[model samples]
Target: MRLSFTTISIFLSLIRAPGVVSQTGLAPKQFLNLPLGEVKPAGWLHDQLMVQTNGLAGHEHDFYDYVAETDWTGGSSYYSNLEEAGSYWFNGMVPNGVLANDATIQSQTQYFLDYVLDHQDSTGWLGPEVNTTKPRYLWGRYPFFFGAIQMVEANSSLAGRVVPALHTFVKLANTMLHNNGEGLEDWTNTRWEDFVMTLQWCLYDFYPDGNEELLLDTMQLLKSYGDPWEEVFKEEYFPKTAVENLTNPFPFLTWHGVNMAEGLKALPATYRFTHNQSDLDAASLGWDLLFQYHGRPSGIFAADEYLAGLEAARGTELCLVVETMFSGSYLYQVIGDPKFADRVERVAYNALPATLTGDMWSRQYLQQQNQIAAKNMNPDPFPTDGSYSNVFGLEPNYPCCTVNHPQGYPKFISNAFVTSPDKTSLVHVYLGPFSTQTTLADGNQVTVTVDTLYPFSDTLTTTIEAAGAFTYRVRIPSWVANGTISVNGAQAEAVSPSNGLHSVSVAAGTTTIVLNLPAEITLEPRPHGSVAVHRGPLHYAFDIARTQKVLAQNAQEARAVDLEFDATVPWQYALDTSSLRFQYSPPASGVLPSPVYDSGLPPMSISATACQIDWSVAGDTFASPPPTSPECTGPTTNITLWPFGATKLRIGEFPTVNLTA
Candidate 1:
């Protein structure tokens, strides 16, 4: 049923839903100051990408010991293992904006490189690894080999062949092929994801390997996964109501997660050679649907171990958040869609921060939008009533989310800027002096230096050396007021680039632009039901520990129960808007477990003046709850009523309050 007017007003007034749109395009390459560690947070996020790589790094042996080694099964792919690996792999790369650097960052980086060296069969397919029993490496094996190619591309000095990774991949691929008529595994063109796999394979397939057998098999495979990634990721077989199981079954959805980035495989070749529309569309939909059905306010899916129906509370793993971001960036670059980029930023900033505590000491194995408490962490975390509101500390169940969560921030810093096709400067994110001597779009050795304190303040200045009428695009968040762009300090209107990007011209000399962001607050209701408050991209919660609750005057006991909202401290989040205060409190004297008051419920509702806002939402009924589950608790007992978003056992739709004589 649709929301009534009162509920709609509350929902429309408080809720914050991110528009389904993209952010800006490329930032000035130099703007991403990677050396001085100004972007340390983002790099930390990147460190997570090769989480398996770093897992390998944590060990003396690359293949043997992985970070989540005991728990993570990257090889057991397209299954639970695939869900784990795909989730983590997605995080390890994207959120952190992984640079294709050497082994310093990831341990599995070498594993992939070595897998290529060791597994190269007589034929061409590098087949990242062998299923000896099966024909292909489980999960997206092509991306596995492709992962090595990315690392090698970052470092040219590590040489052998430009396509050494491909050489190894080809050998293994050939071993599984039809050797004259006795097809090795009897695989006489048993068609699978050859096109998607070979999209990355073909990048090096064209590189000249003496082995013709391996080459032909790859060509056959390349034609398989043509360009469905963009379309397929967004395309759903059924809607929420259409599906029988509201939650996805274990085995079936795992396949969807691994092959999630099928379309993005075409980017390297398309960027290097062809402008394929199919490639772009495939990449777009691949990322779109993930956010659509599974996205949380935290910028991740409701997947503890796998993708859940959208808005389902007990979902979203740190591993998945990181990997989704990694894939999101790949899609963004390939499709050049700004919306994907925007998703990257929002999730990186808000959701990513809460995943790992500010100190980096604690992490949740699984993060949830309705999460109010941290529970036991293990292979997967189980959420209960208590787990909703308590923000105590690091959980015990699945500690991988803890160890792996730290990378979300550092990786975000790394992802802030990407290499432009021409490889010039950087894309400006957050704002800071970014310095790097990378190759720009013009093939010239372009060195860029940018400096700004962004988000905290809004004036960015950049210095470019590979002179010409070089154009740089700076993203102005929709939150900001539109203003004129100033070159070398003169005001001029800058052209809007992709979705959220602004284009500005720069000369050899320093060009300064005053990017303006206006401080304005807006609201939109949730797609499902209920209302949530937000300022900008930030969600608001009633910080109970910080505020006062209304109490009875005859309260002699310190554990006073009869409480209500406080009028003294207005809802700062509302700005000029005001909320009516309840003059009484819940009859329990203080917060308690299983807060069922007003009827046979434990929390007997009584209206009164509030002691503080933080202690409780200082207001009356937005809309009355239908009725509480019948329970009999003794009278004069204590019960806790946490703000809806703050505590797991919160009562947003409270029982009706009546005045006490």
Candidate 2:
């Protein structure tokens, strides 16, 4: 049922995760995964997104006050309501501009600094321990660690705040490593969330002068305490101890979505920072094992409160997708390969959007494939209370997702544009405007000014400057609008795609790559069971209000119309060159409908009217046979499929319909 793929042959020839190849022995030119940011979209959007989150969230102290005031803890009220409010605010501060002389950032960030300084003990430790002797908040170390690492990435001045916090982390590590008198469990009354968070934060700070002994100690302790990631990849990772942990699935592959994912996402980053090759390699291998057991096409491994089979109605929690993206970013840095970045992009583009509303507000607990509308009970054999896309306000159905989710947007901004070990930098994504500077390889300095209207348009440009000669390799995205290169201003002829990169050689000179994303909105069906509608990197969905098709079907069963919206007559036929579309439509003899997002999945509760997908069906012509019954007909139509994760009601896996007419 799976289309065999070769190892990815694209991206710079960096050390990516091991390859998955096709029967042809060809690897994929690009590994479609998460943390996708082309400098064009990633740079600007990262900056803008940062601005949005921090602006909405307030400084940590302010946000802390707001959430604390609500007195909500570890429940839906906290997860959905308080957590999301926190996320929206945090999103505003992620990218470059958000911190570019922004007064709010300067002030609010300072407040957190003041809080840490005010609390530092004589030993340099920052926060109070979570025990009868000292418990600052109702939670453990995880959230605080995530917040602190994020704050460090936001700005260096904020970094000054980290030292004191490290002290506190070291003390906590001391307890866990030593197993001092219920010391570790005392943090959250034995809850592992705090312990895991504490461990991850320590990992982030692994460097010279770091608590190295403590880190090794905690890693051993974590191994013993059933870190699920450790267990799932035990044989693959700790072949030494596979006999011990892999024998049981308790902590090896538990299906609960949020907790285990959070740990996987963070633990690897820690190992990456310390040059713990064995740990990093083990962690990545474990991720592969996890993917084998529970990966979604969206690039997130499943988290359905437990592992659900691949096509099952229950799968990955929105929270798991976000966490996976965060973790993948670190994998990118550690492995220095664009493959990890590709995975990040896949999840970011597909799964992230599915979790939240179009406007970047609200998210879901679980995201399903046979996602049914919230209004009814199991109408399909596969139906479950779980939904495809859910959007509610603040903390929607669960607060853990809400609280955990907020960290993603801002953190995403930080990793969007990355530098090479040699100081070469790239504008990985397109969203808004921003700037960054890096020390390039060969001891040279370079700064980039990026401009684009990405995910909206494909055309974008990046200008680089350095005093000396250097070769900066820019990425040519697989879904590029259209690619061309210009040295300074002179356009270069297209060269053969080398390792998936179109190398534009510039000898100690400035250059520009004119990127054009396809402006045309196109649709492609899949072999398994869905279709994708695309306009550049931004996948288009259907307008429920005007759409005539709503059933989720395969290429054979479904169809789409080329739509052109008119100011006067909106749903009027826009006409494609071909004379075909889907089978089921306005029953009898009416127009076939388009897939819409109004299924009312409770976890997300997304507003039906906001940001109507730019498309709606205006016609349908069968290219193949229709299903026997309305409920279970498979798609018989033959059509090119848009990428999975781009749109709802599209085929991710497909079947051939081979119709000539």
The models' CA-based lDDT, in order, is 0.38, 0.41
Best-performing candidate as measured by lDDT:
2
| TM per prediction | 0.59, 0.62
Worst 10 residues of 2 by lDDT: 603-612
Total clashes in model 2, counting residue pairs 3 or more apart in sequence or in different chains: 109
The TM-score that candidate 1 achieves is 0.59
* Residue-by-residue lDDT tens digits, candidate 2, 1-661: 1111232122212222224221221111112111222222234354435433543233332333333323222222332221233333333333222334456555554443355346556644443321233323223434544455445544555555575466555665556445432333322322343344444443433322455545444544443343334444555332221121123333333334555555554434434333445656666776666666555555565545554544423445766777677667666555544556656766765666555433333345565442322211222221222322232334334445544555555555556565544344333431334455555566666666666544433445767666576654555555544455555666544434443344444455465655443434444542223333443344333222222223232232122111211122122111121322322111232211111112221111111111111222212210121111122123232223222332333223222222233
How close to the true structure is residue 187 of candidate 2, measured as C-alpha lDDT?
22
lDDT of candidate 1 over 332-415, digit per residue (tens) = 555556676666665654455444432233334455553322332222223221222222233334433433443444445554
RMSD of each: 14.4, 12.9
Candidate number achieving the greatest TM-score relative to the actual structure: 2
